[model samples]
Target: MNLEDLRAVRSRERSSDSLQDLRASFYEEVADYIQERKDARERAAAEADDPFSSEEVQTLTDEIETAEQVAEAIYERRMGKLVKQASLAAAGMTGDTDGLTNEERRLYEDLVARIEENKSHVLDVLAGEVEPGAEATGDDDAEPDPIDAAHANPEPGELSEPADDAVAPPDSARDESSAAAAMGGGLDGAEEPAAVDDAAVSTSRASDEEGDEAGAERTTVRITRDVGDVLGVDERQYSLEAEDVVVLPEENAKPLVEKDAAEEL
Candidate 1:
């Protein structure tokens, strides 16, 4: 397909119902194209006394061969999708029926039944025991586990000091030192640990109260631009678009309002 035609097909692929309708029409068109190619091949054969020697015959044959190749590609794509759906259904996942109609449901069930009849090979294909086609768009490299990576790679503020002696006096030592300085005499080494504990308890209580306030307070903002996209929030892109109203935590809402990208709603 030409770029524009492929773009149009991709645009239509967003909704499931559209795909269900488009599949039949697309298959019919492919079948017709294949039939036309076969007719052309026969005509090409007749037009050349030596079909293999004639450039025109060779070109016609190539086009005819291309049509069949394209048809097979389309067929395999449909098969992959059907197999995925059937496997997911067998595994009890039925999410995202936004565009699936009753007819589509029946077709899915029929495919599932056929798959079950040859369950061994079908299961192998689904389980990646068999590579059905090498036409997948995604990188073959497996993605890293996000939760594991996050735990392994903590944020900058979360990084621990090598020791209390490193990076100046950390909060623990500073709080104790400040408390001693405020007392107009340095603390005894024995009392310094107690001073640190007291400071830690105070800090913990303050953080808990602050967290409670932030959690309890929600703010509504009218977005001037798509903050959802900027923040990489999935499925809620529309909610964070320009001129859209969204509710967020007060802590999150304050900066956007200050920047004039959003206003309180």
Candidate 2:
């Protein structure tokens, strides 16, 4: 393409949200145009009586620089749009793909595959259908608990009887138990306080569990733009990008939602 055509392509790309149509040989044409200009510039310089003041050579050099810059801008803008399109397709909402070059189409397909695969694995982990890091090792076998194994398969000659020392209480222990029962008015009186203590402990445990659940509060969101790295309220770092679906602590997610950077999912 010519310098004017490159500028026009860059203008269209900047002005439009969607990708503009381009020929299959667009990149090859640009390369050819730049090479032709370079050759012309060299010939002009060589033929000029005063090479330092060659107007044709200077004009060709400027055109080459501008064309390169415009082409790069057009490519970058199109690439960003393609990435977003691929993300949408991965989420099952296919969008327009009317003007993609063969190379771009391949890139789009690869992006979709990678995004879909990663999303599926994350969802599987959240759904409890897969364990984190389980895929890496391909090992699902769990080690047997030593206590459970011993109980499930005891040795044939293992003794089931109690030792001689466990047969009866010593006289001093019996006397102390009898004294405590008498002082408490009965065994029931002494055991009532222990029963209340057990109930108090149970109640405390329940309260602690409730507090833990509250502390772990999270919000699910869909990112609309690249947020890079964010330090979460849970003291962990999160790397977020456009079209990413993730769960963040409610406090950390609040700012992004309010800023319209992410929407609650």
Give RMSD to native, each candidate.
25.3, 26.7
Q: Which candidate is the best by TM-score?
A: 2
Can you write out model 2's per-residue Cα lDDT over 82-187, one digit (the tens) per residue? 8889999999997667888777888988988888888877888889888877552223487677876775677898744444546678875665454323222100
Alpha-carbon error at 244 in model 2, in Å? 28
My TM-score estimates for the predictions, one after another, are 0.31, 0.49
TM-score of 1: 0.31
For candidate 2, give the lDDT: 0.67
Mind sharing the TM-score for model 2? 0.49
Tens digit of lDDT per residue, candidate 1, span 1-265? 3323432443344223223334435545656766776687778778879878888767766665545544433333333355567776656676233334344556777766665555555666799976785333223586767976775787877864344555665765665444323222111111011112444445545644664675555555556532322221111212233454555545455666665556775
Which candidate achieves the best lDDT against the true structure? Answer: 2
